[model samples]
Target: MSRFAEVLGRLAATIEARKGADASTSYTAQLLAEPARAAKKLGEEAVETVIAAAQGDKAGVASESADLIYHWLVALAACGVSLDEVAAKLEAREGTSGLAEKAARKT
Candidate 1:
């Protein structure tokens, strides 16, 4: 598997393990209890990453991106999606152009 797929697999496993855990014992569980809140956190982190990129702060961008991805995985788990599914779609888009890809979507 590619690096991103490996990471996504690990994240998916972590999210699955966190499912049904006690809120006090696992932060992921706490977030899963309210997936919307976790999703908002991911959005906040994504904004931070954008700000970091705008300022040319590579370290901040990496850190915030990691946080964003973590919360995103949790949110995805709560929504019943798997990392494999996402990876498959990404793989399917490997050779697609951005404009064409967007236009081809069933919107």
Candidate 2:
């Protein structure tokens, strides 16, 4: 795997470990304590990312996108969803048209 992928995997593992940690000390634990809060944070980050992209701020978009992915990973961890599960779903969609995928989901 690439170094970036390895780092992301390690970060996900660390976040998962922090899920049960003391909320007073761990930000991940604090997020895990409240699902709605985590979801809200993810949404906010996503909006920031979009705004950065729209404003043509490459650096801002990268920074906000990082925040967005972190929150998304946190939300997934908080909900007991593993990255492997997500990867499997993506793998299953390989070679499929994006429109077809959306149509299949609606069925």
TM-score of each: 0.86, 0.94
Q: Which ten residues in a row are the worst by lDDT in model 1? A: 75-84
| Per-candidate clash tally | 0, 0
Tell me model 1's lDDT, rounded to 2 decimals.
0.87
lDDT of 1 by residue, 1-107 (tens): 89977887788798899889999989999988887888888888889889999999999988888888898898888778787788899999989998888889957
Please tell me which predicted candidate would have the highest TM-score against the true structure.
Answer: 2
Q: What are the RMSD figures for all models against the true structure?
A: 1.9, 1.0
**After superposition on all CA atoms, how large is the RMSD of candidate 2?**
1.0
Give model 2's TM-score versus the native structure: 0.94
Q: What's the residue-level lDDT of 82 in candidate 1?
A: 81
The residue pairs in collision within model 1 are none
Q: For model 1, what is the alpha-carbon lDDT of residue 92? A: 91
* TM-score, candidate number 1: 0.86
Tens-digit lDDT track for model 2 on 1-107? 99879878988988888967999998889999898999999999999999999999999998998899899999998888999999999999999999999999999
In angstroms, the error of model 1 at 34 is 1.1
